[model samples]
Target: MRVLITGATGYVGQAVAVALAGAGHEVHALTRDPGSDRARALEDFGVRPLRGRLADRAELSGMLAGADAVVHTAFDPHDPVGADRALFGALADVGGRRHLVYTTGCSVYGEHAHAVLTPRTPVDGGNLRARLEAELRSAGLPHTVLRPGMVHGGDARSSIVGDWFREARSSGPVHRGRRDKVWSWIHVEDLARAYTAVLRAPEEHDGRAYLLADARPVAPLAVVEAAARAAGRTDALAFAPVEDEKPVYRVFDRDEVIDSSAARDALGWTPQESDVLAALPASFRQWSAART
Candidate 1:
């Protein structure tokens, strides 16, 4: 299949491109810079980069012309509603497209009173981005929405784990908003495989949404301590009230325990990295290496 992926230069996008290409599929990666090292790295994996930004509607539509499927992982975090509609409309214009896989976050479930969240959970008023993307799936566009958990691992220097490592290095003790705010995590490699599995089996996944995540939720402080240890620091982590105006104090304040049983049963998507805490050290090493 000829798959066109948006945000192909980003942390998640690069992984997805590699996963698709590794599975013997033709991958067209959308990137603003085809000359960058990231884009060059993708070429090593046989992914051809389509030089264009998300804002370029004409370029995006042209790239979609010959695509057998689309996996949208790019969006404006601040203006997700607009970005989602724009991208979906462009993909819908491409006639006879086989599948449209939209990547959303588990935050769409919001703060569920229940400890576990399934695809069947009634969505609380959550992130606008996931909300609008879910709507696109319901609008009859042959779409499959994948709500992945807090993605980590790989050369993800901008992730929460990376932040903890950086802060622990310079600031000593890492301050967090809520020590109890626990959430499910997905390693980038595993998340990429999930995308590949769904794309390969669109006959079963089309017009459906799945929550992809780990087996359990982990506390933020535990992850922070892991980052600190990975960075070779022994500073004691501190927690502040959520009402505190400090930036670090409000870093994280949500609890998400996403369930992926449906995706596993339907698309045979099984995530291998169940112990994200154990993997944090290696993840931080990759992130640290990437930045330096």
Candidate 2:
């Protein structure tokens, strides 16, 4: 299949491109800088980068032409009104030419995450990304929405995890919010695989939205301490108040450990996130090497 990916230069996008290439698919990635190392790497993986912004409708239409499918992995969570409708509408014009996979996060499930969210969870999201996801669903195009959990992977600096790790270790004590709560995490590579799996599943998977996550619920402090262990550091670990005005950390205050049974049974998606801490040695090494 010829797959075009938006945000192909991003963390998940790069991983997804690699996964797709490994599966014997021709990949096209969208990027602004056609000369960056990331773009070069995507090309090395045999991914052709479509140079443009998602906000440009003409570029989008041109990119979508002759494409077998598209994974809309691009979006500005902070500025949804500026770009979403343009990208989604342009693809909707494809008249169902191929699969359209839009990547959205699991925060749409809100803080009431203790309940299992199959393709059937009620829609409620606090952020722009999740709001746009719900709006995109209303377009009635051939789409599959992937709402992933708190993302954890080998790339140490790719996400908010870095701040958590640094703060917990630097603060010398880890304080978790909602103390006895649960949160689902998915390895990046694993989530990328899920993207491809959903794209190839039976048509039954269409118009269906699914959450992508592993089966474990590790608290923030536990994750931090795990990173500490992987880094050979021991600091006090405690649970902090949710009201700490550690406001930036508020983006991850919910306790959601989900069930991906729908994705597992439907697409044979079984995530290998059992020993997340084990990813630390490699993650730490990568960050260290990059710093030096």
Give the top-scoring candidate (TM-score): 1
Clashing pairs in 1: none
Q: Which candidate is the best by lDDT?
A: 1
lDDT of 1 by residue, 1-292 (tens): 9999987788888899999999988999888789998888899999998787776566777888888888888866666676667776776666565588888766565544657788788775555755686678666677788888878888655567777777877877465565677878888899899889987778777777788887877887778777788888875777655676643333366566777889888987778988878897788788778877
Error of 1 at 87 (Å): 1.3
lDDT of each: 0.78, 0.73
* Model 2 weakest lDDT span, ten residues long: 246-255
Reference-based TM-score of each model:
0.91, 0.88
Off by over 4 Å in 2: 113-115, 125-127, 166-176, 243-253
Full-model lDDT, candidate 1: 0.78
User: By TM-score, how accurate is candidate 1?
Assistant: 0.91
Candidate 1: give its CA RMSD in angstroms: 2.4
